[model samples]
Target: MVALYGALFLSAFLAATILPVSSEVVLAGLIVAGRGDPGLLLMVATVGNTLGSVVNWVLGRGIDSLRNRRWFPVTPDRYEQASRIFRRFGEWTLLFAWLPVVGDAFTIAAGAARVNLGVFVALVAIGKAARYAVIVAGGLWAMA
Candidate 1:
């Protein structure tokens, strides 16, 4: 049981990063199998995923130093434009951090924009928890 939960947590964590992990599948499978309490699974997944986004945020915070290097993904002008856009409309986007691909981008943008950490965590957790809650409900309904 512990191992199952641990796997779920790890999957959720990696899923939030640039890596192509899919925590939703793991979560849905666990719920369907009745391997653990649904609520606990939801909590573990949410926390793990949120922490993973935090890792992206941390990386973004330091990305500015590398923007001038040839290896940097975004041009300085583009990064500045993104930062400006994020400063204007980015915080609210954190609420959708549970999304894939773009969700990871949003988190990193939020970090680079220097959004308040507390605000970032609250919004990200809410979005992630709500997503998991829906999954949990769907799994329960399917079982019923």
Candidate 2:
């Protein structure tokens, strides 16, 4: 059980970063196999994901060369959109910051823009926790 959760934590945490991977599939498999505890699973998933996001935040803050990539040229439209989001949402973006593709980018942008790392982490944790909680709860409910 511990091994399963650790694998889940690492897998989910890593997947949430800029790297392309997903733990939800593995989570579903575990739920299907009836392995481990549901509550603990959620906790592990959330913690792992939050930690990964923090790493991404650190990277984003330090790496000032993303714009050099072909995929990431400095465009006024993007900057304007990010600016508006930052201006209006401020720290609230962290709540929805777990939503699929957008979530990863949101966190990175928060770091690149030098947004308060603490607030960014807090909000992301809130969202990440809720996401895993919902998934685990749903899986348990369905199994029941």
Which one is best on lDDT?
1
Against the hidden reference, what TM-scores do the models get? 0.86, 0.83
lDDT of 2: 0.73
Task: Return the TM-score for candidate 1, rounded to 2 decimals.
Answer: 0.86
Give stretches of model 2 more than 4 Å off.
Answer: 69-83
**Local distance difference test, per candidate?**
0.83, 0.73
Reference-based TM-score, model 2: 0.83
Candidate 2 C-alpha lDDT tens digits along 1-144: 678888998898878765666877777667767898777777788888888887767655754666446544224355456546766777687787677756766666677778787888789989988877777777877788
The number of clashing residue pairs in model 2 is 0
Q: Report lDDT (Cα) of residue 41, candidate 1.
A: 99
How accurate locally is residue 84 in candidate 2, as Cα lDDT from 0 to 100? 66
lDDT of model 1 at position 143 = 85
Error of 1 at 122 (Å): 0.8
